[model samples]
Target: MKSPILRLDTMKFTYISLLILVSPILFLSCKGKFNFSKQKAENEKIVVQYGEHFLTDRDLKLILPKDYTKEDSVNWVKTYIEEWVKKKAIVDKAEENIDELTLKEIENKIVEYRQDLLINAYNNYLIEKNIKDSVTDEELFQYYEKHKDSFPLVKEVVQFRAITVDKSEENQAERLFNSSKDEDFDEVMKMVLQAGNAYHDKDSIWYSPEYIAAQFPELNQNDQLSQLISRRKVKISDENTVTLIKILNLKPKGSTAPYEFVKPTIKNLLLNKRKLNLLSELQNQLYKEAINKNEIKINEN
Candidate 1:
């Protein structure tokens, strides 16, 4: 094959390039409305031509990121042209070398793939237009209750509150940390904030051991943390700082995940089930309508 010819109009190219650079947001915003085929037929310039195949400037414009610099854009266009030429050359060679039987098989497979894509797109459209997606909390809770065993924790999880303060204030912080009352916890949080100390009160959220270790590496250093059935206070002290943690709840690895944690999963499962049911109904309705209209004929042997 002859070397691919590059026929670029410098003034036109510069004008388009400047337009892309000046207002990238404008180009991006108009992308969905841009009619590339019509533009190509009317005024699109050929960036490179490989054998009988050619690549248009619009093709490069569509693929190029809006924020790329002039130097980056030039390099990118060069690379794109090289790759495009190689791909076209390979396709041309395949056309010339592939046997008739293989070509026919390839064509058949392409047709089958196109048909599957069309059917899936139509099915999705029907589902989006007709299906009502309104899942309730009650439904999610019911699903969780029935299928709790299927959603077990792979690792131990804990819900806890922790406070980090100076060693000098450990005694007072420990007292506040050990307290079960919300008011006492709030007072400690206020004190910690005033003193510019660290405090966490995510008792409602479940965290893995790794996450806990990351928050308080001192606790995991000696592997002092263990599975607790009830609330337990843990204190760790370094040279200057002291961390006090209260393990509010602990769920073992084999235990079912908390309802709050797996609620989203339950909702998704229910939604998928509803979608399948809707699709099945649509299929049956279409078949029945076709039969009634005598569009589908059954010949008895």
Candidate 2:
């Protein structure tokens, strides 16, 4: 005859096996009735229980990643269960210790946050459905012209070409760098690339003076670096390397920023203005429709 303890252990094992076998069927049947409210049915299969709160296997499925490996799934489920227990325990302790009035205030704040989230989401959906995203170049230019005073240059900006080469090849590079011919510029660029030196040929893009100075430490250290801004061509040499810079354009600090530099900002500003106007129109249209349908009634008592 089996001992009483042995029989009890066998019964426990059987119970767990049955629970595992039926869990999927139970989950499917109860899936539609799964309510997120504080109230829970007494017969629900609880995975982790803390105080009055519990997490069901169904809840775990909802939050768990579908693509996890078998080992990863086991580890993740264990960690999630531990965290849920700890969090629920702490929250239960807080509710028990804190005053009712403070809890009510927290609930009110949660409600307000939900309201804001819903309104913002609805506004974004309406904007996406109704608004045309394209902004013309003419619109951008007009906006920049009107808002020129708003975007003063905080730092001096420059448009320039620069090349750095080994000291041994500086004489040949200097001749190429000073040449007005396009072929000479291309050859200089090829030489700079082959020797694995820094070169900047973005004549259309504006850069801060400090950015150019960084490539040539000698220029950065010079107190009269600003004086070099007026020069069309500049050459600086060190013990190991020589750098040649050709200034294409310069904008002084406090002057209006160039149109190309601020074009992206102007586009963003115009888009935002259009969005606001669309939202305002939506609000007015809704108000009028509500009044026409007798959905809104003003009460004076």
Candidate 3:
């Protein structure tokens, strides 16, 4: 009942309409499936918060030191996020005229710095792994006893030899005070002062003045001679011989240094030394492994 041209036109219109309806369906069919499981897993990650800033587990994994525990990672990430926010705030306030090239250069430098930090973090992990609270109280006591002379008081004393000059060059033994200078000896003395009077032997230096006075009780007791040689006050013993007194150093009285006084400091020192030893061992092991696997290459220039 319709004309041929009208029928053809109607059929063409219908075909176009069908395409318009079907295109989206076809496109969607070719697309990959939606991964709700992956999305859920990503969403379930732990996130750290600091004020308005937030950092997820994934973010922490990037910045966290190797071998950090879950709690440590969380704490560290919170700090990191806060710091990052502060930096971002500062950057936002910075002038916008900074060239894009400079920004890229800074970004590159930041990447390098992060890489260096990663290496340091791994080394710190090695150290932490080896750290031990191994030094016992008994061991400490024994160490103190064996090295009792070792733990000198803050005011150190020394037993030293000195050339006491007298006035008469003939009898350099006992006379008036000598003014002549021994140039070589003076030079050596100057060097000693320059070198901070560095002691050659630890054993030679005594920590207790009482112990020293005990050794030379007679000389120490003799008020006349005590004042003559390195005593607190100088006194003229006789008219003919002037006493030239020289004190090597002062040693305060020694006692058992309170355990509380040294315990924390000793613990930290011992711990750090142990950790350093462990780090050295790890570094050696790493080097050996790298060499075995041809990981290290030295370029000759």
Predicted structure with the largest lDDT when compared to the true one: 2
Against the true structure, candidate 1 has what lDDT?
Answer: 0.71
lDDT of each: 0.71, 0.74, 0.48
Error of 1 at 161 (Å): 0.8
Q: Write one digit per residue (lDDT tens) for candidate 3, span 108-183.
A: 9999999889968986776666556576777666656666555545543444333322223214322221223446
TM-score preference between candidates 1 and 2, better one: 1
Clashing pairs in 3: 167-176
Candidate closer to the true structure by lDDT (higher is better), 1 or 3: 1
Off by over 4 Å in 1: 1-44, 115-133, 224-231, 238-240, 278-301
Query: Model 1 has how many clashing residue pairs?
Result: 0
1-301 per-residue lDDT for model 2 (tens digits) = 4433333234444434443443332223443444455655575446544445656555655665666654454456556656665676678789899999999999999999999899789888876786556689998898888889999999889998989999999999999988989999999888999999988888999888788777666776665356568776778887998888888888989999999988988888887888888878888999999999999877998
Please provide, for model 1 over 67-108, each residue's C-alpha lDDT reduced to its tens digit, 9 standing for 90 to 100.
Answer: 666556666666665666667668879989999999999999
Which pairs of residues collide in model 1? none
Judge candidate 3 against the unseen true structure and give its global Cα lDDT, from 0 to 1: 0.48
What is the total number of backbone clashes in candidate 3? Answer: 1
| True-vs-predicted CA distance for residue 36, candidate 3, Å | 21
